[model samples]
Target chain A: MNDASSQDPEQQSMPPLGADHPSVARILRRWRQLSGGRHTRDPDRKTLVACSGGADSVALAIALAQIPSSCVLAHIQHDMRTPEQAEHDRAYVEALAKRLGVDCAFGIAAVSEEPGNLEANAREARYQELARIADEHACPYIATGHHADDQLETLLMHLMRGSGTRGMSGMRPATPLGNKTLLRPLLEIPRNEIETMLRELDIAWCHDQTNDDPAYVRNRIRQDLLPLLRRLDPEIARHASQWSQDLVAMQEVMDERVEATLMEPCTITDSQWRWPRELLQAHPDIMLGYLPGLYCLRVLDNEGADRITRRAIDSWIRSVKSDSNNPTEHRIGPIVAHIRAHEVRFTPAESSELST
Target chain B: MNDASSQDPEQQSMPPLGADHPSVARILRRWRQLSGGRHTRDPDRKTLVACSGGADSVALAIALAQIPSSCVLAHIQHDMRTPEQAEHDRAYVEALAKRLGVDCAFGIAAVSEEPGNLEANAREARYQELARIADEHACPYIATGHHADDQLETLLMHLMRGSGTRGMSGMRPATPLGNKTLLRPLLEIPRNEIETMLRELDIAWCHDQTNDDPAYVRNRIRQDLLPLLRRLDPEIARHASQWSQDLVAMQEVMDERVEATLMEPCTITDSQWRWPRELLQAHPDIMLGYLPGLYCLRVLDNEGADRITRRAIDSWIRSVKSDSNNPTEHRIGPIVAHIRAHEVRFTPAESSELST
Candidate 1:
């Protein structure tokens, strides 16, 4: 490590450090801190990186390769344009893997012929392929090259689409990718830093011309919306990304309550499922999270069920005084909970509830 | 109603039946449909309009006056600037009220010693005074001339401040204000309509010089940010307002869940409550909603608990799935939930849980 750090005067020009040459080391340190400083076992540590041959993924691959563990390159070939171009991408990733002495896996997926599901389908296919490869190789983790810029773009896209907290939270570092763990080590790293690393390494990467294609929503967001956001505040991308990270962190705390309160198995009856109402009443935030799914099911089951709106919940929560002990069941979405016989049971709406 | 409709040529020109009309009417219709088509007694059967004499407010007042309900005018004297200008506003509103054969009420509030809360304090005082007057004069509803443009500005401001769904939803049509209801019937109407209404009515109103003062956040949003948004999309304000309305609708649904799931009373025994682990395992969404408030309380109670994050929640929820039938207790936020004799209980953190 010391030899590598001392080898280049160009690396020496990086921000001052006692032993670590580049500021990237500090970033990696912070990444560990953010990851709670816990490293999994070697055999269990499997990562599948979504390599796009971009500066971001290239730099990520290089950094992960430095780690003393087996790493695999997972490249997705979205067959939207020329098949030859995708082949070129595979060749580049293979060459990079060859230089690093790591195994590379290339997946070519045909774009869906159906309309409207293009972006969603492509993303789903990419992750599915990565997960499949990881499973086949007995890899526990599937890594991605999504950087700060990507996170910020995701936040804004969700914001524009009028999403709530979960949508606004953006991408996470380690989330379940099917059966495998999807880790994104480069999420906090800026695009510029990744580009710099790629340049310093004298590595060439492919630039997807589709990135500028306004037809795609993500491209439009990248080319048009992001620039406008940057103009509003120069560091907006970084700030938005930070906000997203904070939200995700907050979401984790909320998820705990959900796990603690909502995951009880109940006997499903003809109309409703019996569960302890006290369990739900105890955790307010988790209950709010469960509303949408319940509401969706309720609406589907009973068309006339009153829409469980947000204001109604706020007012109802506010009305819950410290002294209130009455067991109450309010119709929210598809789920109805009523306190009867010393138990709160949640159930679907009756067919009569659906009659307009 | 026909007489009022015939009195205004612009009202006649309004689309008799078309979807192209600014989606406000459709939203109102949908709201009625949701509410079982039973008309709630118009609390604002006789309302006093808080006219800033600006285009937005003026438009709102004009539209409300067109309704069959009796209307009045109310103006607040901030006494911030020249007394003469304040008087001019009072006189303008009085004259407008006189022309419409509606009562007029005027009140003066002293500016706070500190200026940071100037806008908020002023608005609060104004509403308080309006409520008092509404009670005295038997006006069931107090109308504010906040139109679609104001709603859009409000939504943007909330978004910039990183507020959640509740904040981003913007002004509602009818929210309880003490005994009287605060109705913003014109929230769906655009600013252009107000201007057109004023011009058509030949009603000249004074422009508040303070509006040009960029010191206020609303003014800043109107002057600096809105134009940029318009440049990106000319109908940005309209779209934003519409989005706000849609979010308001969505939020109501979420709130219904919060009410039905959370808001249960639990007895505190020595400052600790143990919830049955099975309860949380049943409804994850409800539990998630309780996390934010719980996390906030945990931070106050124990500094070490600050480390409890969203990732923990995700892991904890996953853990619950594995621990089915076997009840376990987990400390989340300020509350602890566990199984004691197969009964779930949630209790506040005792001194020990708070201790580092």
Candidate 2:
């Protein structure tokens, strides 16, 4: 028996399926594609199914049961509800894993509920614990159950909030987390299909009534907006998902071009950087295109962009492109921009004696 | 009399405002801004107000009446309706122009409508006729009455059809039409506002019954989807319009970068072109980024992209970026592509022995 993926003699010896359920077979096929054909071939590479006894994750766990892979169960209680409810979820997940003859890992937490970030904080904590447990079990993969409908809602949320292409791009099917990789094999599958499979298999999963409460904007989007949009066009969800994929692909290409442009024209360093005077003078628009990325790379990563305004970038870009020699200064996220005749430069807050 | 503006005594000397209607006065302010501060300043430059006797355009004509500019009425009848209805539209527009004390120009078209494209054909004919009229009058600007609500619908239409950021960017507040500029001053104003202003001024404009007949898809969208969206989020129209504006700004910045990058690493000619092997080898994503643009510039300009499938592009892009040296051929529009190791080249259909 391998340490990472002990071939459980009891589980493997258990009776094989008389016939493959279409849904289970489909999920197994999808997992094969998502895991890059690793799970079944290399039993040494252990798999962790991240389930919270929710319908989607539970259905995912049941589907994975059809496959012969070394797997472990991981669950986390957000502790947002009563302790009784939390224990129910924990016991439910454990019981489900026991029925499948798999080892179960529990991460019960009394996470602090912040005023405006309850959902996000809980999600982050769960992911952190999932990663820790996966590492403990030497599992290289953690599969979640985010599907196409979730993809659609995500796009609408991003659009309504005036997010650029980056935010509009939906989550990747696979994302690397430290040494482990997290995968969602059901992004192309509809939520109804997941529910249908559970019923067909006579499986039961926890249903949290609070998620459907219209207090959350995403709930309204899911309950009302998506349905209304579907009535408008039956393929709305598919179209929205396709659009997300488009943006994701577009961002990849744009990222590459912008990165190359940055490397060619700018002097990048840990503390500060400057763009070529001629690049700014002749092709100012390209430099303008790189401003958001510049903020990400030089000022700070990711969150630095939210601190800058499109209007400021537009103005600076306009002045650079046009016949304007007027000097301008704009303070953006602890950095003061100095725009002059030839080149635009930046000074860090500490060296420039900027107030905190 | 200036050559550009022979102020007809009969029209100019007709009357002074008893008390300028607030609506008319408001439009005069907008015209000043849209015409680049030249409409009121140079009566000599002249302005053509494209009125269809619809409520929105009639309001526009009424507004233009308050300004000191040489304005003329430009009306087009698609002849899709009964002859009587067309004649009524013409006569009604002429009467409105007379009341506003401006010369009227008619572009009565019995345009041959193609099957499945009645609306588009009519529109194309109308624009061509409007361009001719503007050129004949030496009018530098052609003002229309596309309001914010119209912008919202355009975006929704684009979204339903899976449009890129360019299509989602909505209509420009101002676009150049041949020798003249086309301006839509009310894009920031709602359609109901236009109707309200007309009612306040006690002005009556012809309401084409056909427009309300939900037979048209746009009418259904306006009548159904928009109302539903507004119920879901009261600011749907405003948000959609803002999204369009954001995309417009994004395109402006991206256009410059893509153009510069295209110039480098690609050898172009009238008939065929090939990318720099090393550039494609090292930064294959850059080539993928340029694929759409290459189809545009090397094939049929911007609209050429509509003929290509995103999935096909994604597949080719994946194969190109990944560690696969698969030889592939995909015929896109009038070009046949040969994508192989180290290079991707485009050859014209005509010279490539491709049959019609």
Best candidate per DockQ, number? 2
Displacement of residue A231 (Cα, Å) in model 2 is 1.9
lDDT of 1 at A36: 40
Query: For model 2 chain B, where is the 10-residue window of minimal lDDT?
Result: B1-10
Residues A1-356, candidate 2: write the lDDT tens digits: 12212444554445423125787667766777777764457454467888878878877787665543557888877666778877888889889887876678988545565555666666677788889899888888888888777888876676666554456577777888768889887777777788887887788889853354334678778777777666666666666666566556556656665666655677756656677555666653533555655666556644555666555666656665666678776666555667777877766645566433
The local distance difference test score of model 2 is: 0.67
lDDT of each: 0.58, 0.67
- What TM-score do all the candidates reach, one by one? 0.60, 0.77
**lDDT tens digits, residue span B1-356, model 2:** 22122444454444423125665656666766777764356564467888888898888887765442467789887767778887888899999877766778988655554565666766778788888888888888888888877888887676666665456568988787767888887776777778888887787889853354323567768777777666656656665666666556555555655656654657767656777544555643433555555666555654545566655566656655555667776666555666777777777645676543
| Position A141, candidate 2: lDDT | 89
Alpha-carbon deviation at A98 in model 2, angstroms: 3.6
Evaluated at residue B135, the lDDT of candidate 2 is 82
